[model samples]
Target: MEEIIKVEKLTKTYGSRKAVSNMNLSVNRGTAFALLGENGAGKSTAIECILGTKRADSGNVSVLGYDPAADRKTLFEKVGVQFQENNYQEKIIVTELCEVTASLYRKTAEPEYLLEKFGILDKLKSPVEELSGGQKQRLSVVLALLPEPEVVFLDELTTGLDTKARRAVWKTLSELKEKGLTILMTSHFMEEVEALCDEICILKQGETVFYGAVDDAIRNSPCNKLEDAYLWYTDMEGTADENF
Candidate 1:
C-alpha cells in the first residue's frame, strides 16, 4: 500500500486544553482508514487540523503532499467530506442537490447514476425536509461520491441510518475502495469500524493510543468481539471512535 496521507507528531490545543498530542497517522492509497476515539477525545480536532480548518499547536501534517492548514483549495477539491449532520436547504429537491455537488468536479459522475447507486432516484422530486432520516443520510453519501474524489472523509457516516441502510452504505464504500479511492472515516460503532477500516488510529485524551492494522489491534486486545476489543483499547465502560 502506497502512503497517501502522512502526519508526524501532530498536536493541537484549545487554550490550555490539549485536544490532540503526538499523533502520527499514515493512510495508504485506496485503503479505508478509521479514527477511533470517544467524544471530546480530540477526534474532531484532529480532523479539523487535518482539513486546515484549525491549526495544530505543533507537529506536522500533510495530505497529498500539501499542508491542509495553509492551502485549502487544492486539498478540498481533491477530497470529499460527508459530515455527521448537514443542513441542506429545505426547498432543494434531492435531484437538485446531486446536480449542484457534481458541478464542482472537473469531471463529475452523472447525478442520476449517483442517485441510483444510493437508492434515492425515486426520491428525486422530494424536498430535503421530506425525506426520512435514513434516506437523507444515504443522499449525503451519494453527494459526497459525486466528484469521484480521490480521498473521502466520513464522520459518523451511519448516524441516522438504519441497520439495513448502514450495511448498504458499507457495501458501496467497499466498492469505492476496490476502485482505489482512499477513505478516512470517524465512527462510534466498533462493528462499523471493524467492518470498514483497513487500518485504524486510536485516540485517548487527544493522544494516539494505537495506530496499525485493524486485525492486529483486535488480536492484541483481550476481547472476543470487536466492540469488546474497542473497550479494552480505550479502557471504556461504554464508548466510540472517529470513522468515515
Candidate 2:
C-alpha cells in the first residue's frame, strides 16, 4: 500500500504544555485510519498540525506527498476536512453553503447527490442554523465530500449523531473507502472505529501507546474487546507502544 499521510517526531506546545509530543503515524491510500484518545489527549492538535492549520513546533508532516505546512494551497485542492465544530452564517441555507464550498475546489461532486445520499436532502432549503445537531453533522460530511477529495480528515466524524444516523454515516464512509478514498478520523466511539478503520493509533498524554490493527490491539491487551483494550491501554502505567 502507498502512504498517503505521514508524521514524524511531530511536536506542538502551548506555553509549558505539550499538546502533542513527538507523535508519529502514517496512513495508507484507500484505507481507513483512526486516531483514538480521550479528550485533551492531543488528537485534535495532531490533526491541526497534520493539516497545517496549526504549525508544529518541530518535526514533519506530509499529505499525499506534499508538505502540508508549505504546500497547503496545493494540498487543499486534493484534501477535504470536516472539523469537530463548524460555525455557519446565521441564515445561510444548506444549498447556499454547499455552493460556496463547491466553488473552492477545482472539481466537486454534486452537492444534491451527496446531500440525498446522507439522508439530508430535505434540509437543503433550511437555514444551516435551523438544522438540528445531527442534521448539521450530516451536512458537514456532505460539504467534505463536495470536493471529491482523495483524502479526507474527519475530526470526531459522528459526534452528535444518534445511533441510527451514526451507522448510516459509517455505511456511507465504508462505501467511499471501497471506492478508494483515504480517511483519517478521530472518535470516542469504539464500535465506529472497529467498523470503519483498518488500523488505529491510540494516544495517551500526547504520546502514542499503540499503533496497529484493532484486532491486534485487543489480542495484545488483557481485554477481549476493543473498548476494553483501549481503556486498559490508555490507563496503563507504562506505554504499551506496540506496532505491526
Candidate 3:
C-alpha cells in the first residue's frame, strides 16, 4: 500500500520542555492508525505537527505527498479533521451545519447521507445546543465527512458517547474504512482502537515507545487487553517486565 502520511525525526518543544522528540511514523493508504499515550505524552502535539496545526521544531512530514506546513491549501483539501474538543456555533442546526461545511469544499458527499449514516438525521433541524453529547459527537463526524475526504483525523471520536452511540459510530467508521478512507484516530478507549485500527503508535514522555501492528504490540507485551499491553509497553506505573 502507498504511504499516505510520513514523519521522520519529528520534534517539537514548548519553551524548555520537549513536547515531541525524534518521532517517526508512516501510515498507509486506506488504513486506520491509532495514536495512543497518557496525558502529556505528546500524542496531540505530534498530531498537530502532522496536521500542520503546529510547527515542528525539526524533521519532515508529508501527507498525501504534500508538505503539511508548506502545502496546506492542497493538503487540507484531501483530509478532514475533528478535534477532541468540539466547539461550533451554538445556534446552528444540524442540517445547516452540514450545508455550511459542505460549501467549504469543491467536492462533497451528500450531507444527508452522512447524517443518516451517523444516525443523526432525525436531529437535522435541532439546534446544536439542544443536542446531547453523543448527538453532538455524531454531528462532528458528519461535518468531518462532508468534504468526502480520503484521509480523516479524529481525536477521541467516541468520547462521551453511550454504548449504542459508540457502536453506531464504529459501524460508520467501518463502512468508511471499507470504502478506502485512511483514518488516524486518538482515543482513550482501547477497545475502539483494537476494533478499528490496523496499526498503532504509543508515545510516552514525548517519545515513541511502541509502533507496530496492534496484534504484535499485544503479543510483545504479552497482554490480552490493548490497555494492559499499552500500560506494559509505556512502563506506566512501573509495570514493565524484562520480557516486555
Candidate 4:
C-alpha cells in the first residue's frame, strides 16, 4: 500500500504537560484509520499536530509525501476536512454554502447534486441558522466532500445525529472508502469506529494502549462487542452493570 501519511516520534507539549507523547503512526492510500479515545484523550491534539493547525514541540508529520506544517497549502488543497464545528456564515442558505464551498476546489460537485445526495436538496433555500443541529452537521459534512479531496479528516463525525441520520451518513462514508478515498477520523463511539474503520488505534492517557485489527481488539477484550473491547482496552474490561 502507498503511504499517504506518516508520523515519526510525534510529541506535543504545553509547557511541561505532554498532550501527545512519542506518537508514531501512518495511513496508507485508500484506507480508513481511526483514533479512538474519550474526551481529553489527546485525540484532537494529535490531529492538530498532524493537520498543522498546531505546532508540535518535536516530531515529523508528512501527509501525501509533504510536510503538513511546511506545505499546508498543498495538503489543504488535497484534503477535505469535516470539523465538528460549523464555520460557515449563518445567514447563508444551504445551497449557497455548498456553492461557495465548491468554488474552492478545481473540481467540485454541483451544489444541487450534493445536497440531493445528502437528502437536503429541498432544504437548499433554508438558511443555516434556521436548520436543525443534525441538518447543519450533515451540511458541514457535505461541504467537506465538496473539494473532492483525496484524504479526509472527520473529527467527531457523528456527534449529534439521530440514529437514522447516523446510519445514512455511515453508509455514505463507506461508499467514499469503496471509491478509494483515504479517511482518518477521531470518534469516541466504539461502534462508529468499528463499523467505519478498517483499523483502530485506542489511546489511553495520551498513549497508545491498543493499535491493531478490530476483530483482534474484540477477541483481546474477551467480549463479543467493540464497546466491550473499548472498556477492556481501557482496563475497565467488563460489563458496565457488573462494574457498577
Best by lDDT: 2
Misplaced by over 4 Å in model 1 are 236-244
Model 1 / residue 186 / CA error / Å: 0.6
Candidate 2 TM-score over all chains jointly: 0.95
Model 3 earns a TM-score of: 0.95
Quote the lDDT for 39 in model 1.
94
Model 2: residues >4 Å from true position, as ranges? 237-244
Candidate 2 colliding pairs: none
Clashes of 4: 0
Clashing pairs in 4: none
TM per candidate: 0.93, 0.95, 0.95, 0.93
- lDDT per residue for candidate 3 within 16-79, as digits (tens), equals 9899999999998889999999889998999999999899999999999999989999976799
Choose 1 or 3, whichever is better by TM-score: 3
Clashing pairs in 1: 35-242, 37-241, 154-244, 185-243, 185-244, 186-242, 186-243, 186-244, 187-242, 187-243
Quantify all predictions' global Cα lDDT against the true fold: 0.83, 0.91, 0.88, 0.82
Model 2 per-residue lDDT tens digits across residues 1-244: 9999999999999999998999888899999999999999999999999999999999999999999989999988899899878989959989999999998888899999999889999998998889999999889889988999999999889888999999999999999999999999999999999999999999988888899999999998977678888988898863333341
Q: Is candidate 1 or candidate 4 better by lDDT?
A: 1
TM-score of 1: 0.93
Instruction: Kindly list the per-residue Cα lDDT of model 4 for residues 1-244, writing each as its tens digit.
Output: 9998888988888787778888888888888899887777788999999999999989899999988889998887798888897677888887777777777777876777667777677788998988888888888788888888889999898888888888888888888888888998998777788778888888776788888878888777666778867876766644433232
Higher-ranked by lDDT: 1 or 3:
3
Lowest-sum lDDT 10-residue window in model 3: 235-244
